[model samples]
Target: MESSCPSTPRWNLDRPFLTGRFHQEIKGTSRFASDAKGCPLDSFSSGLENPIGCYDGAVQELIVIDDLLFALVGIEGRYISIKRVHGKADVFSFQVDASMDLALQEIAKRIFPLCESFLLIDEFVESGSQFKNGLVNHALAAALWALLLDYQAMVAQLEHQFRLRRLSIQGLWFCYQPMMGSMQALSTVIKKVSANNYAGSAVLNLLQSQAKAMAGDCAVRSLLEKMTHSASIAYLSILERVISWFILWI
Candidate 1:
């Protein structure tokens, strides 16, 4: 019998969001030289397993795409504030608010690419942030916020459609479970990431706790694997289990 369970989902986000040609072009490039020089952290290299050369590699990479995302966040946040400020302007409020809304909508287009960059860094960067706990936290927070914002938008859209009699309640719930499962999976990893100090003992404890938390949930098993595989470089072996049990449960 052909198994319904899929093979592990490779970080296939590279092709769509990250161009192989561009990735090749950027490799060995010194475009990020100044930012890399600005970082004074010691190099972390343990054989081929964990190798971040004599600068803050994450900062170097962040200079490329991460800074852009941060700028987008600031732009969007500023426009949001502007919209609120003009909310009380009675005379010209309508025109001002309309303009602000349009600007905010334009900025909203960048969110998906920002989310994609955070999700698919494994493809562009050879090694994940094993030695850089700060990098891990920054990525986690960005990814988590993006996931939450997406979930909220989805729920709001579904509810609006349901109120308009465009979707059945049953259908709404069915569509919602996957989103719920994805958020739950994200929360589980955030718990692991939130360990006060990223020590070996902390990682082990997180591994045990996550195993228990996910014991019977087949829906999120694969999603959880993807999240941890991408984000948890140091604990990849411990965190990403074979999904045979997930297959069986389903």
Candidate 2:
């Protein structure tokens, strides 16, 4: 999506949040929402109206992926047919609407970190457990696949946009910063995947290769600390929405 203001910066792979239409679709007719027992849909959506939280240091950062997985598993179970959910979440439906290419990408981004985090510390998603096997591993693999597809599209768009003319130094930084942030997110997941010897190695490797191929000689080698600074506030808002959907879907 293009920014209305010419001076406003645009990100290559901006994060996703629910559009009003998506929220309406799910809340109105989704079997997942209706079948979810005791878990009120409001728990997820209440914050969407005005999402803001202050940090008082009550919550300590999780030191290990196992801890995160433990938290993830604590969600109450309902028998989700993995095949059915996968069919629903496949590439065609991910866009939410014609204009929102990044919608599913953002969801995948939020999910991959959790997936890698869990896989890294547990060392493997035990094949026998329903939660790990059906929800975590299966869902993670699906999300990564969707993300890889989106990333490839982004590479093509970026190549075409930048090929005709070189941007000014400031313009270049604005353009590349979001690209680097996306790479950092991918790199973190890849490291965890490599460490764990996870099942989705093929997908991860392909994603890494695509990123490398797309980056070429551009200065994407170094991590930029402030790459996401401008979007942090909006990121938090999107994150609040993601958490809501996570509870609803899981």
Candidate 3:
């Protein structure tokens, strides 16, 4: 036994060395401990526990419609704006559901033609050199100008109601829907006259034609008739003067 090599020390299974230290290190660095500290498990549990509440909050936030009606009519407002490029006014600065957006765009298409027609007539009149005797054209321009003012007043009233919280998006859309046909008809007549360079009697004749084409019971038909009569007054007066002079000469 004295000649034997030095004996190797054996690890004791019942009392392992540094067992507490190893456990402490593993506890600090374990995957479960890291995940808990990083809040991944807490977030997963919370999401599973109250997903419906989160969804409801999101829906509530999204349901508040803003500036949709004003934008449709090309008015600049809190949530929407307009940009003019190359004489074309374009709406931007807001977004909504696809179907709603499309509907607004369609309404805008009807509204803008009237606006453009008004501008075109205004510019034509203001140019001052385009007409030799512009009394009739001036009368037509004045009539269109008055009509535009009335339309704008109605829009302002609606905007006031909306601002006071008395009108909902659906209600506004319903209120505006009936005006589309009238606006389109007026735009058509104005565009036709404009395209023809507003020749003599063009505006009055087109207005009469459009009025006749409309339903007899229609309010816009009556309006067009009134405008035609008003616009023709100056032309009629001029014709009367010419006839009187011719009779005196004869």
Candidate with top lDDT is 3
- What residue runs in model 1 are displaced by over 4 Å at the alpha carbon? 1-133, 168-171, 178-182, 188-216, 233-250
Q: Write the per-residue lDDT of candidate 2 for residues 167-206, one digit (tens) a residue.
A: 2223423443455445445445445544564433343344
**Candidate number achieving the greatest TM-score relative to the actual structure:** 3
Q: What Cα-based lDDT does every candidate model obtain?
A: 0.35, 0.31, 0.49
Cα RMSD to native, each candidate? 19.8, 23.3, 31.7
Question: Could you tell me every candidate's TM-score relative to the true structure?
Answer: 0.31, 0.24, 0.56
Ranking of all candidate structures by their TM-score, best first: 3, 1, 2
User: How would you encode candidate 3's per-residue C-alpha lDDT over 69-170 as one tens digit per residue?
Assistant: 444443333312223332222111222222223344344344444443433443333331224325666676677667667766877887787678786555
Q: What lDDT score is found at residue 35 in candidate 2?
A: 29
Model 1 Cα RMSD, 1 decimal: 19.8
